[model samples]
Target: MSILVDKNTRLLVQGITGNEGDFHTRQMVAYGTKVVAGVTPGKGGEWVLNGKIPVFDSIRLAVNARGANVSVIFVPARFAADAMFESADAGIPLIVCITEGIPVQDMMRVRNYLDQKGVRLVGPNCPGLLTPGEAKVGIIPGDIAIPGNVGVVSRSGTLTYEILYALKQENMGVSTCVGIGGDPVNGTNFVDCLEMFEEDPNTEQVVLIGEIGGSEEEKAAEFIADRMTKPIAGFIAGQTAPPGKRMGHAGAIIEGGSGLAADKIGALEMAGVQVAQHPEEIPGMLK
Candidate 1:
C-alpha cells in the first residue's frame, strides 16, 4: 500500500484559479486522481476543467462541501504558509505545498502549527507524491511510474524523475514515490518517509535519493541501520559541489565542513545500504 496517498485520496487545489494550479490540476485529473474540488478566495461558485470541479472561497468551504481530505497549495510563496494554516484549520489531514521561495521564518511557524494540529505536510518547494496507478498529487509526472513494490523518497524532484524512469526502463515499478523537497525547513524528511515505507507491506524494496544539505541523510542512515528491514538502495547527489556554494536547491550547501555528500554516502554505507555512485546506478542496485 502507498504511504501518503492512494485511490481513496480526495484532493483539492488551494489556489486552483492560478496558472500553475490550473495546469497541474488538469494533469492530475488526467492521471485519475480524485480531484474533488478547488479553493480560490472570491472565486467561489465558479467551475473549472469544463465545469467538472467547483471552486470555493476558502478551504473550510471546500472541505465541508466536497470532502476534500487532502489539499495541495499552488499559491505564491508569500501566501503559501497561510494556505497551509488554512488547510490545517479546515481539518485537511494531508497538505502539499508546491510554492517555492517561502521564507524560512514563515515555515518555522507553519511547521510547529502543523505538528500541534497533527497535520502532515509534504513540501513548500516540491514535485509532490505519487502512488503508481493509484493517485497523483503535486507535480510528479505519472507516466514514468508503474505499479509495483519499490518505494522511493527523494530530496530532488528532477533526480526523482530520473530514477523512476530508470526503474521503469528495467520493467520495475514503485509502490510510492515521495519527493520530500530540497528546502532547509520544509515539512517531512527522509526518516519520516523511511518509517512509512518500512511499515508498508506492499513495499519490498526502498530507494532513497538524497543530496548534500542538512543532516537529514545522516538521520535516515541511523534509522535504516537500526530499524529498517527492507532492502534499501540509495544515492546522494552534489558530491562535487564546493563548500559554501549553494547548488540548484536552496538547501544544498556545505558549511563548517558538514553536510557533505561524502559524509552522507559513508553513513548510508555503514547502515548496510547499497549506495549508488550515480542516479542511473540506483535501479541496478535495487534489483
Candidate 2:
C-alpha cells in the first residue's frame, strides 16, 4: 500500500551502535518494521536494544548473512555518503540516509553511483519515509501516521510533520510520506516521489510540501502538468521569507528572481495544482 516500503521489507541499520541509530533502531523495531540486522563496523557481533538485533561490521555481512533488503543510515555527516555507497554495493535495493549535513559533493558522487547500480536513495538530511501502519524506515514518529489513501512528499522536516498532523486531523491517512531532504543535491526529489505515488494504486491523491528555495517545485509542477493523473494539493513554505534572503538552506537562497515563493506558487497554480496557503489549509485542499 506504500510507495517504497512495506511489511516484507527486511530492514537493517548502518550506524546501529551510535546514539541516534540505537534509539531509532529500537523505535523502528517497536513499530513493527521487521528490523532484522544492524551494522556498526568494528562493533560487529555486539547486540543492540538488549540483544534483540544482531550487529555486523559491514553492510555486505549484514546483507549476506541476514538478508537485509533495506539499509537506513544514521552515521555522522562525513561518513553518511560512504554508508550509502556501502549499502548499494552490498545489494540493498533501498537506502535511506537520515544523517544530516553530508557534503553536497559527496552526495553527488553517491547519486552517480546509485544511478549506475539502480538503487533508490531517500535522504541525506531528512526525516525519512514511512508507509504508515505497514512500515517505517527513518526517524518519523510512527504514532502520528495512520493507514489511508493520501501520499505525501516533502522537503522540510518540521513542515512535513505539521502537514502530516493536519492530514491526520482531517482523518486522511497517508499511503506514503517521503522526506526528500532540503539539500541542493539529494538522492530523491519531488518528481521521483510523484511518479511513484502516481503509479501506486493505493494512493488516490498527493500532497507536495515544498519550500521557498530551489526550482524543485517548478520542476514538479511541470511533471504533474504533463504526466501525473492523480489529484495533488501543493504547499510552498516561506511565504513570509525575506526577499533576497535564504529562508531555509543553501539551496533555499533567493537570487535573481529564482526560488521565490511567488514564482513557485504561480507555477503550481498554473499546472492545475490546488495550492494551500498554510499547513492548516492543506487538509482542506486535499479534500
Candidate 3:
C-alpha cells in the first residue's frame, strides 16, 4: 500500500477560486481524486468547477462538514503560514502547501506549531506526492507515473519527472512518487518518505533523487545504513554545480560545505546505497 494518501483520501482545496487552484484542482479531480470540498473566505456559498463540490468560508467549516482529512493549499505566500495553521487547527492530519514564496520565519513558526500539534505537512514549495493509479495530492504530472513496485522520492520536481521518465523507458512502474519539495524547511524529508516506502508492501525497491542542499541526504544515508531493509538506488543532482554558486531551485544553494552534491553522494555510498553517476543511469541501477 502507498503511504500518506491513497484512493480513499478526501481532499479540500484551500484557495479553490484562484487560477492555480482551479487548474490543479480540475486536474486532480480528473485524475480521480476525491475532492470533497473547498475553502475561499468570501467565495463561500459558491461552487467550483461545474458545481461539483461545496465551497466554505473557512477550513474549519469545510473539515467539520465534509469530514476532510487531507488539505491542499493554493493560498498566496503571504498567507501560507496561516493557511497551514488553519488546516492544523481544523485537525486535518495531512496538509500539502503548494504555495511558494512563504517567508522563512513564517514557515519556521508554522513548522513548530505543526510539530507541537502532531500534524504532517508535505510542502510549502513542492510538487506534492502521488500514489500511482490511486490518488494524487499535489501538482505532479499524473500521466508520467504508473502503478508498480518501485517507490520514488525526490527533492527536485523536474528531476523527479526525469527519473520517472527514465524508469518508464526501462518499463519499470512506480508504487508512489513524492516530490518532498525544494524548500529548505519543507514538511517532508528524504528519510521521512524512505521510512514510509520501507514499510510499504508494494514497494520492492526505492529511488531517492537528491540535490545540493543541507545535511538531509547525510541524515538519510545514516538512517538507511542502520535501518533500511530494502535495496535503494540514489542520484544527487548539481554534480556540475559550480562551487560558491547557487542553482535553479531556491533550496539548491550551497553554503558552508553543507549542501555539496559530492558530500551527499559520499554519504549515500557509505550507507550502502548504489549511487548513480547520471540521471540516465538510475533505471539501470535500480534494475
lDDT of 2 at 70: 84
Candidate 3 residue-wise lDDT, 50-72, digit = tens = 98989999999998889998999
Q: What is the lDDT of residue 110 in candidate 3?
A: 95
TM-score of each: 0.99, 0.97, 0.97
* Residue 3 C-alpha lDDT in model 1: 91
Cα displacement (angstroms), candidate 2, residue 164, comes to 1.0
Off by over 4 Å in 3: none
| Weakest ten-residue segment in model 2 by summed lDDT | 246-255
Q: Which stretches of candidate 2 lie over 4 Å from their true place?
A: 243-246
lDDT per residue for candidate 1 within 40-125, as digits (tens), equals 99999999999999999999989889998888999999899889999999999999888888888999999999999999999878
lDDT on C-alpha atoms for all candidate structures = 0.93, 0.89, 0.89
Shift in Å, residue 28, candidate 2: 0.7
Q: How many residue pairs clash in each candidate?
A: 0, 0, 0
**Residue 119 CA error for candidate 3 (Å)?**
0.2
